[model samples]
Target chain A: MQTFHFDPVDLPPGIPAFRAEIRAFLAREMPRDYPAEQKANCWTVYDADFSRRLGERGWIGMHWSKTYGGHERSALERYVLMEELLAAGAPVGAHWIGDRQTAPAILRYGSESQKQRHVPRIARGEAFCCIGMSEPNAGSDLASVRTRAERLPDGRWKINGQKIWTTLAHRSHLIIVLARTSPADEKNRHAGLSQFLLEFDTPGLRVQPIVDLVGAKHFNEIFFEDCIVDAECLLGTEGQGWKQVTAELSLERSGPERYLSSIALFFELLRVVGPSPSESVRQAIGRVTAEIWTLRQMSLSVAGQLARGEDPYVEAAIVKDLGNVFEQALPPLVQALADDGIHLEQDSDFVRTLALLLQTSPSFSLRGGTREILRGIIARGLGLR
Target chain B: MSEQRQILADTADRLFADAVTSRRIEGFDAKLWQQTIEMGLPLLLAPEADGGAGGDWDDAGAVLHALGHHGVPIPLAENMIAAQLAADAGLELPSGPVSLATRVEGALQQAGTRFDGKLLGVPWGRHADAILAVVPGHTVLLRRTDATSLRHAHNLADEPRDDLIFDNAPAVCGPASDGTQASHLLALARCAQISGALEAALHKSVEYAQTRKQFGRAIGQFQAVQQQLAQFGAEVAAAMCATRAACRAATRGDASFQIAAAKLRCNLAIGFATSTAHQVHAAIGFTREFDLRQSTQRLWSWRTEGGNDRAWADVLGARVCARGDQFWADLTARDDAVSLT
Candidate 1:
């Protein structure tokens, strides 16, 4: 049976300085009075200007080739940039998907024309992308997607289906839709599925925002009614969508964002509790800190694997699974250990951040992929499946 | 892994596999100690100029991991640390088995080269030719024969953990070496052992899951069983990674944070790893005849040894909290000695 490997990775030289640069940028750009509650959901807080500033600093697509408007930095450098942003709770939502998933997918599998048009715009923070993989009937069983697309004799592709729980679809400039180009084969449910890149302005596309439990409108339901796109819109091979999307998911799952979601609240907890805390509180903080520190090492190991061009999907799944549990548990742990000075009724930063995270923590495991799905992936890696 | 380290690890693993028997689960195995001494395993961290192996902490970690994996009932880690400490202090080590003790009760009084003190929880104290006790600002090497009395004790795994009382024991003493504390080294040793033992338990659980039948199907086929094993695999991976980080940090200087984090992380993983391994095996695992008990019992014993999770967590947490807003900065300031390609 294959075993999991997460070799320790040391950040290359100059990374410390690069980290300082990002810290300086955040210090200069982020508002001094930015509320902790908003920072708790910073990744979902869209700020086009903030993203553009990062783009200007070449932080977006910093690892991609300069041919596509990238700066051609190392993957470790990009990792440092990303982790600093997440750790500081900077609003990176506007171009997060574009920079993280879309540009990478395009660079790896998109047509030259697609790369030329989308990669630069993404790197420039002028375009935003939302994934359209999850459907109303296909939450975890992703291959059960009922969205269908047909190629017309005139060479344009027509798409018809609905995608639910699509984050930021309403505000995104583009959508990467996974559709069945042909009937699903009984022996291979994953076959015949194709990915397409479409502009939000497409005539037959409609997006409706869905309010989350936290009253956020980032989640959306997208409908594709006879949406037509040119043949160049096909991403990668016609029927290799499963392989491509799973690769994207690996990139999605292992980043620092998975575990650092509640970092803002963690800092707030430290701040409110002051330098001297009770033994129980200190123990709680210590436990959480140990987890965060270890998770960062795991995440960095995966990042190093990616840099070395090795597929560590199983390792990534482990990180996401462990990270999701840690993120989801942070709020309640803080609530259980915090002093009585901080309560839900109070409007203090600690209280507000704690409340927001408590409401949003459930989605920490739900988004990207659910805990069950990640464990299934890990089990497969362990040769149990 | 480097080629040299890999060879050392393989050799250690083979030696440990040969040494560990169902009957020798407790106490020192003299033949195994003889073989290790012949192999110079105890001098792994001593400088080459001192006629030692000149191996670094990483090399020692690889061997220690193997020792733990096989549940080798020996004081290899303790002996290695003792030899390295003696070498660093320019003290000549004794020929036979050497146990280590960092936590001594009361003061280790030194009057013109004679020492007196009580060493507590000393692994293999009665079996060792000499015992190395690290008191504040000094490391004293005392012959076991010089002890006034010995109280026998054992951990949950049945390994000898004795208390030795020394009254004006003739000893070789030297000033404590810089950047090498007996406690931190011992903690790192425990972390490496926990890492290896966790992996062994995980391997056993996975193999059992694949073969054991339930409801006319392999129990591993069940989603419930698969998920538990998957979680087990994750804990094992985390322990391994954290231990590696700690080893690497120790190879560099000032590894207080990494060591504390790694030990705490390993301590936390032990609970889940032991429970899940036994849970997956069900009733068979609970039997003393089952080999799974060897790894689980060691894991249980090692978790509390070399400082438990609460102790390390309190240290790590207080340090970070004391840093206040600089917590993130301190966490990110990497002290790794290697460069990424």
Candidate 2:
């Protein structure tokens, strides 16, 4: 049996001061009365100015090389900055995709021209990017993506397909899309797929908002009707999109964000429970505290593995699987333990936060990757498949 | 792991494998205990000046993890703790198995050089050469043969958890040293044990799922079984990380929060790990003859040995709640602020 390794990772030197700096930045920038409801979905809260401020601090794309406008900081330092932001419920949506997914993909797989064009803009928080992997039919079976990018005779690429659940696509400056560049191979469905980078302002491109149950319009559906781009837009080698996108997922799945989504609600719950709580309430609080603390350690361990240039794909999947369960279970557990006033007092900060999380928490397991898909990955890691 | 820890872990893995084979899962295994003593395993945490290994808590934790992983039936963790506590208090102990008791039913009255009290749930008390108890202000070591009466008991794993009564039993006493409390050390020990046992259980379940056929194919092929085992793997991972982090934290300094959190997380992992292991293994796992029972039963017992989930949860939750808005700040401050080499 293949065993999972999450060796304990100590935060590197200067992390405490780095953490304090982020805390101070958040305290200074974020309003004291920032709505609790908004904080519940803080990462999805788009604030261009806030993201720009973080970029100004050299916080975005922190682990990348300085040649691409990155600060060349350690992954652990970036981890500290991220957790501090999430804990404070800072709005990081505007640069979230670009800094987390696009810039890294470009740095690792993109040509020098591609990296120079996108990575610097991303580090400066001037260009926001949205992912284009999922389609109406390709949710978890991402290998079945049918979006096509055909190389034109004139050495340009023409794209045509629809990408669904593309977060903030309408507002994003660029979209990194996974499309089939050739006929799919019967032996390997993952073959023939390629990734393309396109500006949202490109011709024949359209984005429509998909409102969620919480009335949030962050999710978007992008239509590529022969969207044309220069040949330089093709990311990495042709037909290696599967490998490239899968690599990006380890980054997406293992970060502190996976577990800290509902931290705002947690802090609110603690504040409401006060110093002295009933035995049951105390136990509830303690259970969640332990869960979050352990998850943080697991996340950090994965981060350390990544910094050391190890591919911790299975470990990353485990983190997301456990983290989503912890974050998703928090709202209801708090509801059962908290006073009924949360249900009646809709205007109160605690109630508002709890209500928002109750609706949004379901998406925690749905987005990124479904619980079933993540489990499949972990099961494969266990040598079960 | 450091090279020193790697050597210790390898030594422990070999020692436990040779000493506690599958045939001797239910009893003390005196031959194994003798080998353990020969290796100076019990003095792993004692200072070098005290004629001991002088290893740190992480080293001891690595040994305990191997013990639990192999389902070794011995009081090695207890003995290590007892020897270390004795060394810390400047008290000399006999070179034999020594069980530790942090939970005393009543006060250990010290009159001159004798002591009287009940040490509750002393692990392998009847078999131990001596029992160490950390009282209110003193660390007291008493020979098991001096006990007035002994009520022998066993945990779910069939490990001895005897209660010993002492009435004016001749004992060595010294002032308790500052640093980690006995209860915290015990809890951390169990965390390491549970973390190891969880891995064992996960290993068993995954192997079973792959081999045990159902519906004309391996059950592991089914998404349902795979998902369950995957969740089991995750719990095992969490337990391992939490235990290792707590042990590392203990070696540095105050680890109240890490120990409490580790114990609580390990306790939670035990529930899911054991249940999932059984569910995946089906009837073979439920029987007494299978080796899975060794790891699963130990997990069941160890979850509550040091302090149960509710106990540690209370400590951790109260601490976070008391911090109020500063909880995040307090949590972040727990990490060391050292420079990178």
Per-residue lDDT of A167-211 in model 2, one digit per residue for the tens?
A: 988789988899999998889998899888888889999999999
> In order, how many clashes per candidate?
0, 0
Write down the lDDT of every candidate, Cα atoms only: 0.87, 0.86
> B1-341, model 1: which lDDT tens digit per residue?
77888899899988888777534546888888888989999878878887778888888888999988989888899988988898878788887588899778645555537777799999999899998888777788888999999999999988899999888778788888553488889999999998989988999999999999989999999999999999999998898888888888888767888888999889989988999999999999999888998899999999988888888888888887888788888888854234422
lDDT of 1 by residue, A79-180 (tens): 888888888888899998888888899899999999999999899888999998999999999999999999999999999999999888888998889999
Compare the candidates by lDDT and give the number of the best one.
Answer: 1
lDDT of 1 at B51: 71
lDDT (tens digit, per residue) of candidate 2 on B206-261: 88888889799999999999999989999999999999989988888788899999
DockQ of 1: 0.62
